[model samples]
Each structure stands twice: as structure tokens, then as C-alpha cells.
Target chain A: MSHVQGDAKKLLARVRRIGGQLGSVERAIAEGAECGAVLQQLAAVRGAVNGLIFQMMEGHLTAHVGGQDSGMPEEELAPVLAVLRSYMK
Target chain B: MSHVQGDAKKLLARVRRIGGQLGSVERAIAEGAECGAVLQQLAAVRGAVNGLIFQMMEGHLTAHVGGQDSGMPEEELAPVLAVLRSYMK
Candidate 1:
């Protein structure tokens, strides 16, 4: 149970929801759904994935940054954290 | 077809890929995948979906913030576009 595994059940649930959202998007197009509705679904999926990313990103941060116990000095850890932040969002 | 519907087949394919990525993520967790590997998959899905979001967001901009023919003046469109930009990414 590494710190990177943050509530695996929760993560799996979010992934399932994202999968369902994608399926809905497909169905929307097939049914000749209007553009506004389709676009809204896509945006919703993106928001869900972004939330999942942030959740996993937090796990990475806690493991590598390892809080007070981390042997890596601030100067070294700062750049790593900076790079991670840039990518996560 | 209104401007908001940009290549439905292409959009559907991307959605499918995102769905597949999510499925893979679920499998990884179920199989007791290592933390680093799971995180990598999460990041990959995020990138794929981000690309999809940009595509749809572009459609939204073109349709609503429509170019020269749009009646919306700069003052009105500016804030609208700005708000869209803030949300899309």
C-alpha cells in the first residue's frame, strides 16, 4: 500500500464514471444530439479526469516529497515539485 | 451542421481512446499494479482527454465567439472568450 495508491476503490469508481461519460458521448452523437449537449458532455468528462489527475498527483507528491522524513534537501526537491506542478494541471 | 459539430467521427474516436485508457487504469489497479505504473497511466489518460477537450473547446469558440460575422462586440466577446479560456484548460 504505497502512498501513491490513494483509496484505490475511489479511484476505480471515478474511472468507471469517466468510462460511462465517454459512452454517453458516443450515444449522443449517434442519436444526432445537438452540438451544445455534446460539447457539455465532453467538458464534463474532462472535468472528471482532471479531478482524478489531481488525486493521483497528490499521491505522487506525498510519496516523493515524503514530508519531513524526506532526505532530499529543499533546493533539490523544489525543482522536482515545480516540474510536477507544471504537468499535473 | 452548425459550427459546433466538428468532425463527429474524429471526436468519437478520441472519446473511445479515452475510454480505453480508463479501462486500462481500472485493470492496473485491480491487478495490484505498482504505484508508479498506475500514476503513469493516469497521466496518459489526462493528456489524451486534454487534447479532446481542446478540440471541443475550439468548436465552442468558433460557434459562439464566431469571427467577423458575429454580432457580439469586442467588449462582450472578450469576457466571454476569457471565461471560456479559463474553464477549458
Candidate 2:
């Protein structure tokens, strides 16, 4: 967590929001919300989680893997970024 | 919840797994795991959530707008499925 940089406050807020979203999702399902509504809520959560990943990636890239400053080669970064992209989609 | 079909057992299991994954992410972050590892965990969680969405979509589709047998026109089902597909990615 300490290693992660760039707007820690925003990241913390996003994490809290995700927790709350997950809670709502559980409640919606438990209380028997319609299938459509449940799916919508789940999708929203998915989007939120995806946003968080993007933020983390941005922060990491700026701090450690900035293209100009990083000693690591493009080939090395490519596979890592690809893995991140795969999770994102 | 009742409207969703095609495996209540599996859906419940997926939900529980997601909850557990979230807990692990939180724990890992708190324990000061490396940035790459945290991202890995978060990505894994994201995939888990996406998998849950797909399962939910399948279950809902089977019960409701199932092609041919659903009594729903293609035009009507198309947009609904499109929305689901957008979230899935």
C-alpha cells in the first residue's frame, strides 16, 4: 500500500465506495431484487472495480514504470501490461 | 433472486467467493504487499466479479429472454443483452 502513489486519498475513497457497493449488491440479492436490477447493480460494481484497476495502473506507471525513466525494456513491460489488460476486460 | 435460474448453488458459491476475494485484497493491502502483488490480487478479484456477472447473465437469460423460446422479440432482447455485454467487458 505504501508503494502505491498518486492521490492516495482518491484511491482510499474508491476502495470504500467499492466496499459499500458490494454491500448493496449483497443486500439487493438477499432482499430479492429483480433479476434485471441485480444484474445492473452487479455491472455497476464491475465498472467500479475496473476503474480502480485503471487508477492503480496509472499510479504504478507514473511511479515505477514511466517509459522514459524506467530501465526495464518495452518487451518486459508489454507482457505485464497485457496481463493487466486481460483482467480489465 | 427467485427469477434467476440455472444453478442457485453455483451463484451462491460465486458470491461467497467474491466476498472472500475482497477480504483477501483488503488484507493484502493492509499487510503492505508489493504493488505488483496487490494489483495481481485486485485483477484476480476483478476477474472473479466478471465471472459472477457472466454466471448471472447466463442464469437470467435461461430463465427469461432465452432465444427462440422466450416469447420475446429479437429487437427487445438485443438491447438488453447489449447492455449486459457492455458490463461484461
How many residue pairs clash (N, CA or C atoms closer than 3 angstroms) in each of the candidate models, in the order given? Answer: 0, 0
Local accuracy of candidate 2 as per-residue lDDT tens digits, A1-86: 25453354566667778878887777777666677887898888888888888777856775677567789765777778778777
lDDT of 1 by residue, A1-89 (tens): 66545577887888898889989988987666777798788778877876777677656666667577787655776676567666544
Off by over 4 Å in 1: A4-6, A72-89, B3-6, B63-89
Q: Candidate 2: where is the Cα deviation over 4 Å?
A: A5-10, A71-89, B5-9, B67-69, B72-89
lDDT of 1 by residue, B1-89 (tens): 65434577788888888788889999997776877898788878877776776677666666667677787655775676567666544
TM-score of chain A of each: 0.73, 0.69
lDDT by residue (tens digit), candidate 2, B3-72: 5533545666777778777777666665566778878988887888887787787667756676576788
DockQ of 1: 0.38
CAPRI quality band, candidate 1: acceptable
Q: Give the Cα error of residue B23 in candidate 2, in Å.
A: 1.4
